[model samples]
Target: MDYIDSICNASASILDMTPAVRKPEEGKVVLDYILDNCAKWPNKIFLTQPMGGDEVLNVTFSEFLSESKKMAAYIESLNLPAPSQIAIMSKNCVWWLMADLAIMMSGHCAVPIYPTLTAETVKYTLEHSESKLLFVGKLDTHPWNEMKKGIPAGMSCVSFPICPSDVSYDKWADLIGDNEEIKEIKKRTPEEMATIIYTSGSTGVPKGVMLSFKNLTDTTFGLINTTHATENDRYLSYLPISHGMERWVGECLPFITGLHVFYAESLTTFVQDLNRCQPTLFLSVPRLWTKFQLGVFKKMPPEKLQKLLKIPFISYLVKKKLLKALGLNHVRYAGSGSAPLPPDLLAWYRSLGLELLEGYGMTENFNYSHMSKPGGGRVGYVGEPSEGVEQRIAADGEIQVKSPGMMMGYFKNEEATKETMTEDGWLRTGDKGELDDAGRLKITGRTKEIFKTSKGKYVAPAPIENQYISNIRIELACVGGRGHQAANAILMLSEDAKKEAAESGGKDAIEKELEELIKTVNSGLDDHEKLQFVAVVNDVWEPENGFLTPTNKIKRARIEEEYNPLMEEWYNSKKKVIWHKW
Candidate 1:
């Protein structure tokens, strides 16, 4: 069977499955949503914190409300300003949400810092945001020790109930202990600042995007309309809640949808946690999706699985078994965003009965822009502009958006803000995209990432890289040939691929396989866009290594800078593919 064509035909007839449009309640903030839900379903499990060994800690809606109120009362007792700026640097946990709610209910703006950031960047965010108080939650002891040194001497610090060892600070428990529940929560206007989220700093210094209560509420409603999530829906919170996309969907969406949110205990236990929660809504970035694909290939070789899947009866069983093994059988809605998801990956999942949708958004807009419609699965396009979102392709090909969910602007960066917006008030998305006949948005590449070759032809690397990354063996691919004859690629092998190479015919066989892969990819590209040489690097691209942003996007400029010096040497060697020596 021609699965691709079959799937496309099936998808063409799939109608939009979203629920009827229900306008968001007027003049209500996220806190109000939580409070209302608590009143409506006091005993509903609001959050589940997974503990290793099959143990879990669940918090009911009423308990969450009460604890948050007590924490808010304690925050008010500190006598801080009405709109104090507080920072939370932690991984996803129950305490993180508690601190976030407390900060908001206390009429303070929350500044979320990615726990994976370097100490220098962490300090920069703390100092740049001018945060008055810092809530230290789940973090690595060594990094926290290093980061704490940079905190201002007089800044108040509070530690979550469970924190890194040897960290001496005010405990969150002390703040809530024996404290009277705050009878009245501070009322915040829809336009008031709710949080200042720092970007992942892939290219340069992270900018603080100031999102208002209106932005959050608008995005929450927009997502609800798109995904049709319900109170009974379960969501696994594994992605860093610090990310605006995750914050809006994984964290804030629950407040309005009344979804039961589960926290992944750690990376090692993610698969187990996923099985335990059986989340109906699963949101992940491209990298994790790629990793999940790799995990599947590891269990069953691609050739064998493909052959087996050709049998109609076997295909159903195969997909069911595979999805169950991956703990994704119950995922009613699965989405990939933050970075581009390869079309092949999307189709592959669709073939297995999981419709993985592509979404597009940025922190500036609180992540409400475009998403693939429930059943309108246009393969490469991130479906039509979301309800109430206006989008256009500029003459330069940049995608621009006008939405109610747009951030107020980058905090304290008026000049930068002015540069990001057009005279007509549309926010510059920096992404180059095209709209299909059906009005689905297909992102071509980043405007800044397009590079010119010596022949004066411009090359967009993302599409080219996507083809190479579809191969499970390749973990990352960076295509560059600025001022050169043709583009070259830097390939990072997946751990399983590396192990296979070592166990099989070693580097020689790996190079041969990669050359064939490159040839296959090049056949689909234009003459100016074809790669001349491919360089394989043994290093892993990770957030800690500064090669990837917290959201798992590659730092292209940084990668180019690190490898540009070796380009000429690799080219002069006359090898079709060269392995870079450290």
Candidate 2:
């Protein structure tokens, strides 16, 4: 049978159950929800932003509505074209949300640019979207200085209170000072465009994903239903809000659920902010999660902690203290996404009584695809399809999905849009995956990332890389084996690991540990998939250096271009672990 026929037969039993749909009121756009909340809870605190140490700015529902209205009025007074595209380039802060609401209120589409993006990318996004205005807020001074050069000299710009003092743009307070609230709030239809979110661009140049009101509402409402979100829940917003995952979970969900959102002040104060908020719902990427685990290990050595956990009474106290220290004590729903989470990490958190869920999605679908449910999770699986989402596997093992939250198309890129969708209207997720009998999905590898070895065997890098990254000493791992005798990996050591390596006899100890780790990892792999060597690189990989994306995803093309030439030399050396510095 053909791929479609096979998919239909395979999913027939799994799809027999009725899928979850959005609530009646959930069909309304985000603006409508904000208005309803203003009427229902005018005095309720909705957003909290940290100004600095021990000082925070809070905005209530009524205050939020008032400020959004005044900003909307100011925007309308400018008399740009109706439904003009406006861009907000800022970090996650209270003004980012206010500016977004104002843009929607003024009958304009919003475009969000990652705060960590380079000047070239920022320029490309603004020019591609044809944005007429820009709002600048909360950014690192150095990146802001760099990104400011990309703004067209003729384009009008507005600055939030937290913006750099040196900027020569019209201040937000000044623009709204004299303008009256708009007489009528412009309401948008479900089909109307809400935002154009650019992808994080791990493989190539970023593409703008055009999302509508319906797309946002469906994903937000679906999450609310699944998580049982309420106004009492608190969320800490630390992830970049420009990405689809954070925008949907941290920003849009609050509009519908009235959840209290606390903005993290800075990296140095992240744990402090988390402790203050004690959020009830938390979302993070695997890298941060690994860091948290390392922090815990630093405080209490793993061997000692394991011994203490053997005692029943001490185990409870240890778990509670650990969660409290991480500011996840009150977290009822914790999610990890954007990259594959190691199963070991999931088990570790679960042992501490945190039900850490693994979710799978893409920007093209507004990040509504699959999410593990409470008490129904299996290790190494991304769980069943999310509410109102339908998924199937193609003949080539690629996973295809259709969801109510799917994007309209790429902005001004019809050819790329066509390449991303199937003839039957499903989004072609480049991920290769399989469905369990219960319809849970497990990703195998990316179609574009698989490479061939000299032995004519195919190698999937992600799974092998996951094995290496599970070691606390390793920070990032990349595997490549195109025309090579065997697959090999490049690893960057964690900060603490690097410090340890600098000490007397430390380098030898680490080399021994890494050799053991390699042996352990190879035991689980097939003959061709086993890594031939582990090369420790001396360089750092970050977004500023063009080695990683703004979302912490590695830039595969750039990394390969820089390192592939040395593969033959490293292989011929016949060393199991080679430190680049040595």
Candidate 3:
């Protein structure tokens, strides 16, 4: 069977599971939930952030409300016009959420910028959003000297307590009064602007996506109902809160559900934080999941683990022990999104007793489009449309969606906004997808990323690339061949793989293993889709290197552009794979 047919067959069993239709809470906003929770669960731990050496800072529901009110009062004191724009550039932290809540409380729109963004983009976002005030917090990787130049001259700025920058700014502590009492909360209507989140464009300039209070609240409620999450659940906030997925789920979801959230201090403390939080709900991207698998293999080789899993009683104990060691034994709902996950990887996780639910959504939709249900083992598909979400595949294979959570539009870009949505009002997702026989959506590739080969046959790279990276050794694999006879790939070895290669036969051993991996992957593809040659690059893709988005998604177009010059020479080489010497 072909690709579409195979997906349908795989999803046949779960097709009968209908999605739950939950009505959004229209009368209440996210802020209302926070205020109500404060009254109901005043002493409950609302947010947690780790410091060094077994020390952690916990904020109770009451304290969160009080602090946010004080911050809002300070913001109101600024005397900025109603609905003024305020920009926040920070990593995920308690202050980020407090500032966001404060912005809404003061009747202003919050604009979030990824903390890792460059000075040029930062300046462009600040100017384009027309933000009157800025909250600078936890800018670890940002070039402060160069970035401060981008801040509009004399623009009022407040520095978080933990901010390491020497840039001149008013301290958040001095701005707030001793008394937490503030003016009565300003009630915002459902249609009132809440935030303008700029897209972390993997290609080209980032555009501000305008979202209303209604959009975010509706999406949060939908997710809570669909996932069956409750106040007892715990969440870890580590992903960049500037990204829409983290903003909605990691930040907004906690307010609605009253779930306790723990913040990772840094990458070094990620494991310790996870163990301390023991989060009931966890969301991670595909790359991290692969890393987790690699971590497991490091302790016990994959071959050994597979053989051990085949044993009857020992397999159960092994799986339990392995999960606990990874600090995921308590994770009831594990989700993967922001990129497509390979089917093999999903199955591998399932065997270890962690059902990695694949979700499908984008920044434009408040990251609430489709998600796999618990106990529903639909491996390759992203499950059915979410509650109150309508989806259809366009004639050209793009997935179109209409939902209450959909963004208002691209902020201040009318022409681009018009082009993004259909005349009939469906938002164009720009992703090529197909609905399986079970009505589950399976994303095939990106519309703009598909390339036509010299043989006049079009090839979608994502699916092939996903297959290629299924091997744990292959960290990143970018597939492309716009005018070539066959598709080619640029492969980067995983960190562990690189170390293993260096220890064991060096480049020759790495090349041999990669050649075998390519042969194995190509055997599963059709002639036109098979990778003719792969250039093994030593450099790893990273956000700082302009190869990955802040959310850790590969920048496909950027990778292709960077490696275009080396492609022809690699393709002309006699060997099936060429090791690129960078």
Q: Who wins the lDDT comparison?
A: 2
**Any runs in candidate 1 off by more than 4 Å, and if so which?**
1-18, 141-146
Q: lDDT by residue for model 1 over 1-582, one digit each (tens)?
A: 000000111232223443587667789878888878999999988999865577888999988988889999888988987797999988898889988988888889999988777778888999999998999888766556766766777788999876786767899888888888877788988989999999888778999999999999977887777666789888899888898877887778898889999999887888999998897788777778889988888788888988988999999999999989989888777877666667788888877888877777788888778777667768777777788999999999999999878889998899999999999999998889899888888889888889999999999998898888887778888999999888999999888777876674688878888889889988989999999989988778887667888888889988998999988888888788887652
As a whole number from 0 to 100, the lDDT of residue 33 in candidate 2 is: 84
Query: Cα deviation of 394 in candidate 1 (Å)?
Result: 1.0
Cα deviation of 173, candidate 2, in Å: 1.3
Residue range with the least summed lDDT across 10 consecutive positions in model 3: 1-10
Tell me the TM-score of model 2: 0.95
For all candidates in order, the CA lDDT equals: 0.83, 0.86, 0.82
* 193-286 per-residue lDDT for model 2 (tens digits): 9999998888888899999998998778888777767789899998889888888877898988899999999989989999889987888878
**TM-scores vs. true structure, each candidate:** 0.95, 0.95, 0.94
lDDT by residue (tens digit), candidate 3, 386-491: 7889999999999999987788999889998999999999999889899988778888888888999999999998888898788888878888999988899888
Question: How many Å off is the CA of 252 in candidate 2?
Answer: 0.8
Cα shift from native, residue 520, model 1 (Å): 1.3
Error of 2 at 50 (Å): 0.6
Candidate 3 global lDDT: 0.82
